[model samples]
Target: MARMRWSTSHTRPYTLRQRRRGRERIQALEQQVAELRAQLATQWVQAQPTPGTRLDTLLTLCSALLVTHDLPAILQLVVQQAKALFVGASGVLLFLSDTTGQMLELRATSAGTLPPMRVYPGQSTAGRAFLAPRAMLMAGPELALALDEQQPAQYAELSNLLTHWPPVSALLAPLRLESQRLGSLVIYGGSRAQPFVPRDLPFVQALADMVAIAIVDVEERNRTTQLASQLTQTQTNYAEIQARLDTAQAQLLQSAKLAAVGELAASVAHEINNPLYAARNSLYVVEQDLAADAPERAFIAVAQAELGRIARIITRMRDFYRPTRTELEPTCLNEVLRATIELVHTHLRHGHVTIQHELDAQLPQIVAHADQLRQVFLNLMLNACDAMPTGGVLTIRSTNEPGDASAASIVAIQISDTGSGIDPEHLPHIFEPFYTTKAQGTGLGLAISAHIINQHGGCIAVASTLGQGSTFTIHLPFTPPPTVVLSMYSTLS
Candidate 1:
């Protein structure tokens, strides 16, 4: 075995002095190490987040980011905070360009004093991190040692650039979501100490996630609020229309009741007069044919005829009061309309209202009460006659709708009076009950007409412009009236 030689043999005379210096150096180093440990402890404590609150915060931040339209502002703030948090070398935030053909663009950088600002295409190491999006660490002998052995010139170049600002051994974390690279967050550790170690990878990753979620959440909230406001506005409009409808319906009811009364009055007059006239004629005939001594037939015949008239009057009265018993059958609208016109012929003749019928042959038969429908026509014809005090064209037309098969088979009777137009504002409420524009009119005729027609599954509408005359259109539902679903509320116009 070779004898071991100690180098201290030459310095023996100075041993005590060296020992004293060595002890002092040890004490100083120990103190410094203790101070450093305290600093590390503080940093560790600060790093701790609220208990189990990370996920909740991430969720809230994500929601906020979705509503933010200005991603650039969010990115700026993030980068600024990152600089302080990392306390590492200078950082660069690189963003992707919109154009697919172009390379990545560095939107901002902390290296404010570098060569006049320039954009870097997807080519350099920073670009590689952006493209690959993975955290990278190279320190100790591995870095310089690799640089020394691999490519000294390139290593020196990279070293110089990094030293310019961050001034350190470094760690680079790719800023990205999934595989899509938005940018990169580069941290600087001064030459004396690296900013991060392998232990800190999780924190870097967590920070990156928070930034991504925050950006997405802000944008979404803004969009949701805008949509909600638009929906609210739409609902408001619908509500206004509903209010108008409520008022219109009340008017319809009043008009319908008046019209029914008017028809009843007219029917009663006709019924009563017919009997009175027939009985008088029967008496005259009996007087001329029977002998005074042999038969005395005038008194008997006149009395019998009067009784018949009384019976007829009572029947008509019953019909007028018991309107609910109107017979429902498949009635052709054309027949009912013709009958109504004939019944009101004298009235129209008196008013000088010319009747025009343009009944479409295509309309199918409707299921309705014939007499009720006849009354509806009578009311309309009479109104038209009244409108044209000096004679005007009253056109009635019927047509079938091609679509709406269930209701398509339609009969439209339009009673247009060239006398005078109604106000536009009143047109929409014409179907409402108790509303009338005529004098000496109960206002119920039109409303009742609308109600009766609607009960038969039809609709009545009026269109008029002041000074342009008015046209009342009746569209009878092609389908038979379904069994009325009885309830506390009555179905009316």
Candidate 2:
């Protein structure tokens, strides 16, 4: 009410003072905001890992690879480390099928909820990761849009986990090296606060690469160890075989030496026999010419008696080297074996060799040279006696092989000895000329016997084992006897 004179200039001075205070307050508030922003920037720098620390973590993951060769163990480790690096994410390591590139196997997982499952390369989040060369991120409707409805279950399982966890985003990185697509590393965002970002893709991809390298190294090492074991076994077998061969060669040389000595003895006996026969005849004539009471006649008679004894001994030696008849006849093989055994019975008893005959009485007659066949058995018997210098059994077996009407009838004769068995190496050459195992063998006996049997359409085979025994098997075909020739003079008479 004191309408006294209102001074506009005084009011202007108060208004200007208020405006100046307001500007000072605004400046102070702006300075405080700038300081807060700087503090936030520093905090962000501190929170993020340094390149060196991140590299060390990656190296630590790589070092873990050396500890195991198992594939599942390696992949589990990879997923665990990936979840730690990518904060608030559940991840899986998938392995691609070598045969079908479309097949994706979820080998390992960071979270334990997902059972081991298989998915297709074009059908699910893991599949798309495998198909793509670089890292990719999907969020919201993109996950559903990219999924193949035809493979609903595989993609659906992924959807269900996502819905339950309700991740804000999902990321995928390929486990690839050059052209080889090993598999994919898949991660789903676990929370909105720590969602998967574009910056995280490179680190996930780097981790995938390290895992692929470890897989290749483990497989190569397993293959190398297997090959080395196989090579060592092969070498051991080869050495054992070589040792046996050397033993056989030494036996062969011993057999050859005995045959040479026997040949020399036979030749010397043949040269001495003729002269000794002439000397015995002269002594016999001198005994007849002298008087009965003469002293010289008595000396000549004694000389003739000694000479006759020498002749009988030489005849026995000649009989063994004599040639045999070549005529064939239908004869019983068993009878021929018995006769040959009789001839050598005295010598066998002297050498302490026992003969055991296992004759097949039902055996059919075979067309053979009786004299020659007998000689063959006799030679075998003598050889058996020589083999058993310390005494053993000589087993002889004869059997008729059963056959169809159209097939040829066969006879199998086996001569076995429980003597110092022929060396396996020497057994093969037993029928070769001048090859023998005996100290006094002529070596022509088995060779000549084998020839005769072969001429009669037969085969002979021998089997022996060192320190065990030997068996000589003879197989002969049944053949009819030859026609006998008659003289015209006999017919006229």
Each model's lDDT? 0.60, 0.72
TM-score of each: 0.48, 0.50
Per-residue lDDT tens digits of candidate 2, residues 219-250?
68887888888888888888888877766665
Mark the 10 consecutive residues where model 2 has the least summed lDDT.
Answer: 481-490
Best candidate, lDDT-wise? 2
Residue lDDT tens for model 1, 388-455: 77888888887776656453556677888887777777776565544677667666567667756766
Residue 344, candidate 2: alpha-carbon lDDT: 89
Clashing pairs in 2: none
The root-mean-square deviation over C-alpha atoms between each candidate and the true structure, in angstroms, is 16.9, 13.7
